[model samples]
Target: MKSAHSSWETPDPGYWTKQGYIIVRTDERGSGQSPGLLDTMSRGTSEAFFDVVEWCSEQPWSTGKVGLLGISYFAGTQWRVAARKPKGLAAIIPWEGMSDYYRDRVRHGGILSDRFIDFWWKNGVQPNQYGMPGRAARKWGRDTIEGDLDKATLEQNRRNQTLDTVTHKFRDEDYYKTRDYSPEDITTPLLSVANWGGILLHLRGNVLGWMRASSEHKFLHFIVGRHDLPFYYAHCARLQRSFFDCFLKGNDEDGWKSGKQPRVKLCLREGDAGVDDPERELLFPHREEIDWPIPDTTYTKYYLTAEQQLSTTSQSNVTSFAYDAMEGKPLCFTHKTSARLEITGHIVAHLTVSASRSKADASPPSDIDLFVTLRKLDQSGNEVYFTGTMGDPVPITKGWLRMSLRKTNATNPGHHKYLPYRDYFSTDVEKIAENEHYEVDVEIWPTNVVLESGQSLVFEVAGHDTQGVGKFSHEHPEDRKPEDFAGINSIHIGGNHSFITLPVIARG
Candidate 1:
């Protein structure tokens, strides 16, 4: 839905129209034929979306009820718009879309996710600008109905997301605050679908959105596969139609009619289902839960041993592991188990960490970038990868944090031991000093995987991204300058700073 390119067909008209639905897609302001300022995720864009939904609900051909559904950009906007609670808005199906713009898209752990922003701007936004010429020739969309704007006017009207993201580092800044809204305000009937492999982006936001929304009729469902394919799958389509049919059309072929359906439905990932294998996906096991976090989920801590091993025993001893900030290698600790352990729900890592000067360094770094990865290995010891966004192989999950941005908002209602919440405000920047140990918690993205006997789990911490980052990378030269982030990083393993909390589900 980037710029609503107009030719993108993930909506599948044949599928919706045949179900007696009128499919209406818009080229939102400054996208395609619409002429105005081109601000992708600002409050202005959300207001426009809110207005358009109300407009659709008022049309003479309308049934006075409207349900919102879309993937990626289209889906991400739904949370903000639905929070406004416009007239006749009935339900929303935000499949694989992020709800939090700051946490999910622009910044990862307070670090600028500049690569994806630049890539999206050039390929997704620039070509489809309101006044761009030759759009029809390029097959992007029809050109501006009003004569194209001059280069100066065009440049002045749009916000460069990459530039704005780089310029603003904290949530309190007007740049991000203008885009922020409370998900708790969204009371629309909702069915939010998350992807296990959306490690670098929407995974965390989707899960949080479902939890924070005020909708009594909300449900959280999960799926696996490439980004665009799963949304159009027959089974997923049936699920969507059933949800909207019940809420918008006053008919429920499924249990949604009486709201007796489980609030959480999950795809159980036990082994390597392989990437984008649609046939095998249908056979994956599933579980239905009346509440998330499973109620019986025991938050167990895994400690780091002197030998860099992860264990359940309380091995109390001072141990240190160091990695070169610029060396591009990570310190890994693996845990192997013989019992079936279903690790689901929220995950967090507690570590006593510090930065120091390496021999190759001219000066010590002022902060550390902790890139954490949780991985699964088969019985024979080969690493197992799951289907991530765009069908790439990713680890079980990933988390990130900057030592300077390690301050936690413990007073906030959303903060919990299972998930360390941070406002990422300008005031939360606690700069690191050399040789001083500071305790920090990193919020890993939510995941679901059943560990079979002899399978292993590995947790990694590094000064840079390890793997499965794809285009959503934080490699902007300004944000991660060598002088500020390149030196030596250390993890103090013992007591409160050396363990990861996993949501261990009791096997039946």
Candidate 2:
């Protein structure tokens, strides 16, 4: 199989060699070893993977069938290539990689990703194209360098700005076209593996790909802990090897020999404070349930009361939180569990919001952020947090819609109602307006949880960061404390329209 490292590490040949699998690790186009313009978002990269597969099949040492493997960008390319239905491509194991560039990796809850492509390209993508800088040069750099630095060294970096100029063209047609994977075309068998903490990366896109693809033999596995750390474990590695062995080596029944349904494993760690959890902790594999928005769910609405409370009872003319950039966080609502219950499915948010800035001042329309968080409170009143596919601890179950991008799709049923899929949205160029109120829906990614009696299922609606609370939270020097955390958010509510929607779970 063909695998290449992101600007970081290349595939470790020693590991693949021991398994008797021939590994082809090359840099993506415009990256190391390869020559061409760098398409950071996997356009040319997908074609490269397809080319490698065909090459491998034709080689003397090759089997007719080829399987692709890798994590993050590598994992993502699997879907992009599979969508192309490359000849000789057999199956794919996209570990912790997002399927949709628009939904999972680049944007979250309609907010521009905090991890900007420009920043990543400048800091991560370019350096890998060149050899690692010497120790002296490393001191001035800002990325994951291991050494110390001085002021003069930092000054030198300001002049080396190739990445800065390239990534600013994010919305260019060339960039978007390079990353598109229109699912209707993908027919290959797929096994998507991800870390629960890798939530923002692979979690939703994995589920979306598994459910929507043209392929019938698709599966998903989510083993919790952190991103990329699972690959080092014995059990995890065995699972991956078995997957490739069955698909690539034509060992058809091998993966199912033990009578286990294809599973989604979630690592369960102790929720105690001050206890450091090991990476790739444990695996809890679940049998496939019905497709998401689980046919079994009741599309229930929890009214956002004028009093700022979430209750099952319906109310009208609610008081909304104005879209104040400086507003405090939204309040949370919890329900005491009367029985043991497990909620496994997608959650939706529907609210009416208005912007404080004028159309001239706003970035075109407005990109408003609504934060949706799901938490489980123990009987002792302690809160438990889960890690997202990004390998960060996020109480955030899912995030959606920056308001202005809330376009309705007349074709897709998933996009028709209060449940809005996080598909990409473009600007409505001619109709832009300022300080207008609009109703929109946000779909939080799917999650699986078991709540016991006396414990409550809690949902917090706020505009703030959920990262700093846990080890798995995505962080950087830029994120602020309380002002950005869940405690305060500014929202405006005045019309009879403001409210939040929930997929009410009911026992059969």
Candidate 3:
């Protein structure tokens, strides 16, 4: 079921309606005007969506063919329903959708995104619930029938969803797996649109969905803008029309049928504010390739050295930095390149760390919570942040991990080199013994950037996000603002354990 408000309207329905195609938007069960418990992303919701699709195919005005297209919640539902492979479903465009509920939304890097979820529930879901009194209800009118459900039932549904997220701290739990759909189950001809700045919700799914989906006719496109802006943009809309026309209308003349569409179209940011242009035109330079994780990518390793420097050569000397887990600054390492470098694809950092009880503290910390950020710096050493999907400047990419959940899943294969999948299921939690060291691999979200000559790559290893400033501060309540962490954390560097692996693309 769609969780967002205004599910009835498509971004630009005229593009489809003008082509003589019927567009249907239904309020999902328990949402909008639909009568049912508002259990978000439940198996029941998926089955209900399937029933709607199949029913639509049998309608009098129907051609017995159906397709799905939408952004965010709409896009997310498409992934879940398509996995069921509903009969009469022809194609789907999951534009900027989050595939995995745990990885993409709730628990990022095993940390609860309490702020985002709380913001969503209060500002997004509650106000738009069937009979809620707010702007959405004033404009769209209340779903009086569904509103008939006792207020207690409505409050319980909201509470259940939030409680489920907080209680199930690990990903391997049944709560998360039941809501997660396998990309292998999605066989429909699919066009997945991803946004580069959608680190918080959209990017991971778009990229991972394309990689895992068993569909033979799948295509991926990357756009740079606010999460919802691309859906209505003429450039993206044209692409969507061509894809639907080729699959649904059997239009052989459509560019997609002629093999003119690139398997991956990545947009590169050109200026400070990539989303500044009001029209949101595709103005940046881009690359077209047959697939993602570009074939000729050179995985480069930049080691964290004793002198707080990032270098290509591994050093034998071990380095350590201790910080108050709650208020200490991050351990940063900067490296300046001699020549221009273009980096694309997934990035992973191999770190060896140990935690201990601080002399000034009363009790020992059971686990170490680490937050890693990859950033760019100008020649003058100023931090470079890019405009994100929300119109705010954000660092290159960020990753987090509770050291206790750092065990890697050797059985689950990685999608790319240096990108090993970690298992949050196995609970092998242990406190650090004196002089004990643990090897942890942190997966920094995938990024595409062109580092000009003399530009420096800066890596920050901290207990919390350094960019949590002003309007952009969306932090995990516990991880970001811990009441008190009575321990000093250290990052060990030397030998083979401390290096950041970058997916460096070779230039001609």
Candidate 4:
């Protein structure tokens, strides 16, 4: 019953209420009207969610069938509860919810994301903690109900929430796994909605849930827009209604029957503005498919060459570049295609990298942090940046990896010839030998992009993300500092060590 939607947001429940559906919204423990401390995604919250769903079904006004739906936090709880398989829970629409807390939130690609989490904690969740007077009370009157928790309880809740994310920076640890749930554990019918711009938190989870979930009725739709915008978008709302009606209300007219609904629907970003102007001036050209890693996908390898070029043919020459972890220049490779191309799936790059301590510094970094970004350039060689999750102009897709955690998971089913999965578990850590080359594979998230003829594809390898530029100033708090990265880094190309595999969708 806990609601992450603001009290002032009428459209969420308003849409359901108008459809003759009852909406039950409650505050979870330690927030708003709840009394206990906020434990974030702890097991306690999952149990409370299960209890509330069952309680709601028992009510006289209920039809004894319950379905879960929401965006972000509201959507996240559905994953946890569905895994528990609450009795009355019939269907779930986990719109933009992250399934793995470690991979999706605290540590992304084994790098701590302290900036976004800190910002989210201070600006997003703190204000809604139990002790603060409710927004309703402030807007309504002094007689209105204040939050249930006292001042002491609220402070303790804040401390606990902070420790949950900041304390543990490793993945698959007891702290993170205890609060995490596998998609395979969920048996309920699911409709996952993903946003391409939700790189900071939502996108990965949605895709992972769809790909890993064991549900036979699972459906995934990739939309073009900001994280929260798509949840209320008219098209998305209608689709959600159809899915719920088919599952929760036993209505077959909703167009969600097996063999009827496409397993994946991609909302391709078209036009110059990209997904920035979702309200207007942008078109969401959609493509439907029965599965992802799309069947018949043509995997093409683009080898990294010596002359700062990407070519289809492999090269034996080696290339190296020196970068000052914090401020060094990045190595870039460009490919100008003669024919138009459309890329619509996962991309993986393999590179041979090595690092050495800067002579000026007594101590050097034991491991290297690499940030890989794929960008596009127009015919005139101008960078083509798109509006991404942070509402700023960013490259198409970005990948990150800490060299020490680059061990591949041999047992992961998702790993194959073209696609390799990096295991972020603590056991996978293998320290890098100073100045010894190590082959590492970095996986960029799935994306749909159309490259016109004469346009060029650009790839950049850097020690840190570019910042201070116009519309690209955002930085993550967990970015490795200059002192920690006082070293010279090199990227080796040639032989079997350097190449990128791209899923090139065949065009008629």
Candidate 5:
């Protein structure tokens, strides 16, 4: 479903016809010329998707096989349609579409991306900003639910609601019922292209979908740049054609399926870092041995020293940093410069901390999100940056923790290290040991950066928002400061609990 202003435009139905393929660009239920309430994909929206695909298959110009294209919302409907398994459906090229709607859309690292989605709906999808040209009138459409079911205006719409009203139910029934997809029931072939630096709503879902989907033939590709950058121009279109040609038209799998099976892929060295240069070519794609969590990685822990040091030793009950709210100092952790090192994986911080308040207002048994950034500085003290197709600097890997969502005590010691404390929500935050040290695991986001030996690796522990990385932005123009951001809490760092774990890749 192309938005009114989205550059989701195609090269005309003639292009597909020339290739002996038929293309049908119908206004999905409520949006364009179609008559229906503008309910944003409630239960009715999923049904509408099924109807659209089925309708296209029944057309005389069609060959009874339907495949989906486009990005963002274009890839979104695939979740619902694929889950239903329409017989006429062939394969899907879901460009950056992840299966878990909740994780990709609303929340990450247990923190609600309070600004991004609502902002996108208000500006991008609903209003079609960014100067992209389109003809669909940008207006607030109707709701499919709560309206006359048999009338022409509401018939096409399946639900009468928008995401703005249903933000409260991440773990509840409202959004879950409509947004959730049954990965087990979807067996169709899929080609999911993800963007490494897609801060808004990319990367994570692509990784999860490629791993979780029941589809036997699934290919995962990663590009670099802004979330929607790949959709514009001809690059994304050419790749989409290759995908549909192989799956929809029964063409030979030449470009679509070829070469070194890359499970985890990255678009190579891209973008200008801390320097001004005319942005280079649009994109560069790279492949990896494993899909998620990176492959062939040697996971090593970098211990924190009491005297503000980073070491590869287990100096038990040693490292600690003072993290007071008003006078907290930013601690620096560094390793000896070696050869050039490229660290590409997730970095986790396993810390035991104590707070000044026995019952702190800010550090409640709630899942509190803290920001962790991995940076590199050259010998001359210059910060290095990376850019790719999307024309944006990318972060390696990121993680989250809910103060109350933490789970530390597992009977199995082997599994204790890999416990579910990463971001899985737990209800009992109040029961954790009070006025004492408790384990706090801060997960850094995934990243792909190259650092030289003479240079240093820096990890920063911050409580408020840092604009350089993920989508959680306090200064986002559309975002009004929410209640959570206003709260303040102080972290106590001591010998028993506070250190950053680094996965150091030895320099060659």
Candidate 6:
């Protein structure tokens, strides 16, 4: 059900047992001790998980009230299973898990995130696959209870995530469509923990789940620190225990039954803090709000000027900046902060752009891949970085878009200010005619940063990955052909054609 060898960073059984609660650890189908066709994240696997949760409700010694809790893959499964509305499922805490497979994991803004898919398949998923040879000797997990399958059988037993990811380009594909679910169907009482540092994969899903799930008791808590460590933090554990105790045991000691608790709790990244430093990360502040993106957020726009600058007023003249579609430094614009302020929520960039042939004889590129980065700079013009998933000092946030999939779903209810929802389906694809300027809105992942009076922001536009992508890159050759995506990309910052909409919290 999950990719982490079914170890899942599950907490000690003895601790919960001592609290008069029984904890059951499961090696889901085709993982750990369980044996079956290995199809991680497949619909069939999720159905099996649904059966298990229902069975737990029928157990004689069980309270008939089940609470699901885990990290990453384990957490991600909670969302899918809960969507089934399994009987006796009381509550869930999906810590740092991705909800949308296509948008969050396989593809980013429509580009195939093949690098992370390859890395995760080898390191996190395949090695722990049931009956994988040498799992016992190499300490991946216990040897299979049954005799291990042979080489050919092993290869045939599992779904190849890498191959499938390459094959499935859009959400409408059978491979991806079958995995999709409505977040509103997840009606379980939920505590969805999102990590701001998990910008690459887990961050967006967690936020979206919190925003879209129909659970009235659902709460969104944004934490800071390593994904591995934050979930087990003493404060986080206390939060989990209180939530579970209220729902599972009928003990509402924390007033979770009523509206006493804050629906949204956010970890404030105000000043400079080192990546992966838990002590310093916890040193940051915490704020309570009623909703995600804050209801009163002032979505301010920073205009991309013809002078190749980020300004408040648009220049009268038209202008454009160019960069090699498959190479070269990103074009950047800076805006110095005049007052101390905090920007904490979703971010979106509006751009007018086109692709073309590099030379007279070269062929035109029919597609363009746009990579945008929002970086923080100190008063002295030095760059500031936040903690990335791998401890890499990354920008405040990043966004991407494949030019052909630039059509926005404005009619959808989810589409709103500060965020543009795009259906990355085959039918949603727009023809990217060469040299035709198209206006598109790029959805940036949620982020948080408090800037001092002199601190500034750098808005970077590029044709390829900038800082903070880490191992999750999109460089698949067939998917990004040179003739279709490796030419010249130009950003037309004329009038209102190009600008970035930043989420600003208005201090009342």
Give lDDT per model, in order: 0.86, 0.57, 0.74, 0.73, 0.55, 0.85
Query: CA RMSD for every model?
Result: 2.2, 6.8, 3.3, 3.4, 6.1, 2.4
For residue 366, give model 6's deviation from the true position in Å.
Answer: 0.6
In every candidate, how many clashes are there?
Answer: 0, 30, 0, 0, 31, 0
Q: Residues 1-508, candidate 6, lDDT per residue (tens digit)? A: 1232224466545456656777777777777788888888999889998998899999999989999988888888889999999999999999999999988888899998899889989898788778887898997867887878788988888899999888889888899888988888988999999988888899999999878899989999888777677766667777888999999998897888788899999888888887778788889989999988799888888899865667877766788889998997999988888887788999989999988889999988888899898888988998888888777777888899998898888898789877888888899887688889999999999998888888988899998888788898888887888878878899998678899888888662
- By TM-score, the candidates rank as 1, 6, 3, 4, 2, 5
Rank ordering of all candidates by lDDT, starting from the highest: 1, 6, 3, 4, 2, 5
Please report how far candidate 3 places residue 207 from its true position, in Å: 0.4
TM-scores, all candidates, are 0.97, 0.77, 0.92, 0.91, 0.76, 0.96
Candidate 6: clashing pairs of residues: none
Write the residue-wise lDDT of candidate 1 on 1-508 in tens digits.
Answer: 1123223524766778778988888787887888888999889998998888899999999998999888888788889999999998999988888988888898888878888889989998888899987888998767788978888988898988878889999999999898999999999999999998898878888899998999979999988888877787777888888899999999876778476788999899987788778677667799899788678899999987778889887576788988898665899999998888889999999888888888653787898988899999989999888888878888899888888888888998899989888899998787788889988899889999888889999999889877888888889999999889887888888765689999999874
Q: RMSD of candidate 1 to the true fold?
A: 2.2
Q: Indicate the worst ten consecutive residues by lDDT in candidate 1.
A: 1-10
- Model 5 lDDT tens row, 60-106: 88888888775666776776788898768888877766556655665
Candidate 1 error regions (>4 Å):
1-10
Q: After superposing candidate 4 on the true structure, give the runs of residues whose Cα lies further than 4 Å from its correct spot.
A: 1-11, 133-152, 279-282, 417-419, 467-483
lDDT of 3 at 491: 88
- After superposing candidate 2 on the true structure, give the runs of residues whose Cα lies further than 4 Å from its correct spot: 1-16, 116-123, 130-172, 255-260, 263-293, 306-309, 321-323, 355-367, 388-392, 413-437, 463-508
In angstroms, give how far residue 39 of model 3 lies from its true place: 1.4
Clashing pairs in 1: none
